[model samples]
Target: MVMTQGWIKDNVQEGTPIKVARIYMKNATLAGDDLFIDNLFIGSDYDNYIRTSLPATPNGNFVYDVEVSKIDLGFDINFMAANCGHDFPLLGIKDATVLSGSAEPYSDIVVYGHPDFTAGTNMAVGRIVAATKPVTGSFELELNGKLVTVAADATAKKMKELVETNLDTGIVLVNQYGTCAGYAWDVEWASKGGNQPLIKVWCVV
Candidate 1:
């Protein structure tokens, strides 16, 4: 009998998310209140530069995110509702509940006070201090838990289709940066209704 390593394979071709770069944090003033990770306070007002804190349940202010003292959907609903198709890219943090093996989809992504997060590299499975967009520079994809400059043609197309259908249910979440409108591209999910072994992002159009 001959032993074969060829039989070994990975669950996902793109692999899983890895922490390549350290997270980038913004300096902030507490506005008369103390802050902690994932606290959802106004790190910079709703415009993403919270200086002072607003009410426990602030309304429509450019303050950080949410007023969930009343379970305010973190006020993220207001942001999404107000900014749905603006095409003006904003920063976001992955929700706390988004641990391994499951994702909360659109609701899982938030605008502010997400432990004061912003865009950068590395989507660690359970890191609250992390981001989801508009990386200050070009980004890469994860293949086998390692960052790759690009994905294979088949892998790129497959990741897009799988995540779109499974996570977004074929709904277009966001476009590939610097591309034409209506292009159906999306972000990576820790798990989109199932386990995805790697950090899959737009390596292809």
Candidate 2:
């Protein structure tokens, strides 16, 4: 797993800019394999800047020299799974789930599922953070875990209503289906059910 934390410096001297600081886990083991850092960025009202690249050095760190000029600060972190590869069939299935109601079906859905069916699991983790003086705003976080399917009739309508109502104030929507796990119909059904992953929206009062 990857861990990251960022905050805006509030006590800078007049005319002195506040730089962004970031730390990442180096030489760490994730899901039984070595992990790699992909990219990092800091965003505010004025600008979004990418931090310097970490050089595969264990316990590596990077800092930005430019001062932050905006009141609301945001940070985004991304990482790649070390040994994961793409499963074309699974990708197609996921696309179908997301676009089930569209007028035209995505062509990618045609290539999913094979008789031999040998595909490795793909996993990704990411986080976005927004900072303020008193943190008086909202932030949205999306988590992908499991997937499921719902009946096209009343059950689907009820599920949609529950998701819209239960999602936190800052969260827009949490979606899952045929994406996280492999070509298992049960996985898809579980994600569509009420017991699957719950998205939490952050609201600072």
Candidate 3:
């Protein structure tokens, strides 16, 4: 096989300003393998910065930084509820039997304390902390777990109410789909059904 060699030379020293004048190839050749130039990084003094515990990019420009907590586009719930368009439709539970000292059949439904918990046999699950009804049709419930915190306190309280109220049930030991509203730590799992990936929030008008 015909072999070829490539070279890269840097003249700038550490802590010195660097500007690339030009890059060129020395002996142009044919009848050999093609030349490939991959991933080019300039002025990347990564190791020295780590060794000295200095800022990685002292001269880097700030492109943009965006921090978003919650967003609500008013939606018509009458239309949504009429068409069953609720992001998380309440799951109806019937004839549910709880085995003593067994992990609940759907521990991930609550999902605050048991983030990594998968449905298994004989695993202890979190307990319901509190349940309250905001309206005639909806309920919210809090279970044992870490609470999700957000930048806005009102948004956090609103979300807590939406989640806890949606799942709040008066029925003795019933399971249903719960919609978690607003920004939360565990909001990644907030959704319409069980055993599915979490989706972004949908608002009701």
Candidate 4:
């Protein structure tokens, strides 16, 4: 279990947006049951403000206040939970190509998207897979019909020159990784008796 609290200082004006500076939790356990957060008070001054019961979702009530006016304001978040059978997963993990570079005038790149599900449907899912290959040789830069010498570790400068000298010039990064793709599924059905909806969702690696 972890208990934490912190404060945030921000500048704003009346009638402006007021961003939430912080959210404090008295007790947070990874292996806890479904938790509910309530009694949230957010505003610039104690006299005039708004209050409500927050949603009981992971990372849901973390941000409570924002710039309501063009003035600086502050608020406090209070919540509690119990130990049960609920756990959160870790995010931000990528083992594939992570490309980042300057965009060219007309170049094509691959993009991906996730699936959308219907409300009260019980389940929703999506998947994406990619593969790459490698090559080794003396890479060269050409201007007009002649090969030009480009300094090592000057990929950016060389690329800019290529684009300027030849409006149709381009740069490409090549590598080899195995093929990767998978399928996902989500299904939900109302349970018999008085039980809630039974839901199942999964993805293949």
lDDT winner:
1
lDDT of 3 by residue, 1-205 (tens): 1122223234445467655588653324411112433234444442222234432221231212223333263111211111111222212223333344333333323212232445652222233321221222222233333233222223333554554555332122212232322222344244334553232333222
lDDT of predicted model 3:
0.31
How many clashes in each structure?
Answer: 15, 7, 10, 28
Q: For every model shown, what is its TM-score relative to the native structure?
A: 0.15, 0.15, 0.14, 0.15
* Model 4 lDDT per residue over 1-205, tens place: 1212233333344477656676645434421123445545555544433446644543332323222223233222222222321222211113322133212212223222223323322211111111121111223444345454333223333435543444323332222222111111221222223333222212222
> lDDT tens digits, residues 1-205, model 1?
1222221223324344433354334425411122334343322133333448444321232234422232332322222221112222233345533233333333333223333455442333222322222222233555454444432222234546544544443332332422111123445453336654545665433
Give the range of the ten consecutive residues with the poorest summed lDDT in model 1: 80-89
Residue 142, candidate 1: C-alpha displacement in angstroms: 1.7
For residue 171, what is the lDDT in candidate 4?
36
lDDT of 2 by residue, 146-195 (tens): 23223222122344444444432222332322322221111123234355
Runs in model 3 deviating more than 4 A are: 1-11, 26-33, 46-205
Q: Candidate 4, which segments miss by more than 4 Å at Cα?
A: 1-7, 10-27, 30-32, 46-205
- Model 2 lDDT at residue 147: 30
For each candidate in the order shown, give its overall lDDT on alpha carbons: 0.34, 0.31, 0.31, 0.30
Lowest-lDDT window of 10 residues in candidate 4?
124-133
> Where does candidate 1 stray beyond 4 Å?
1-136, 150-194, 198-205
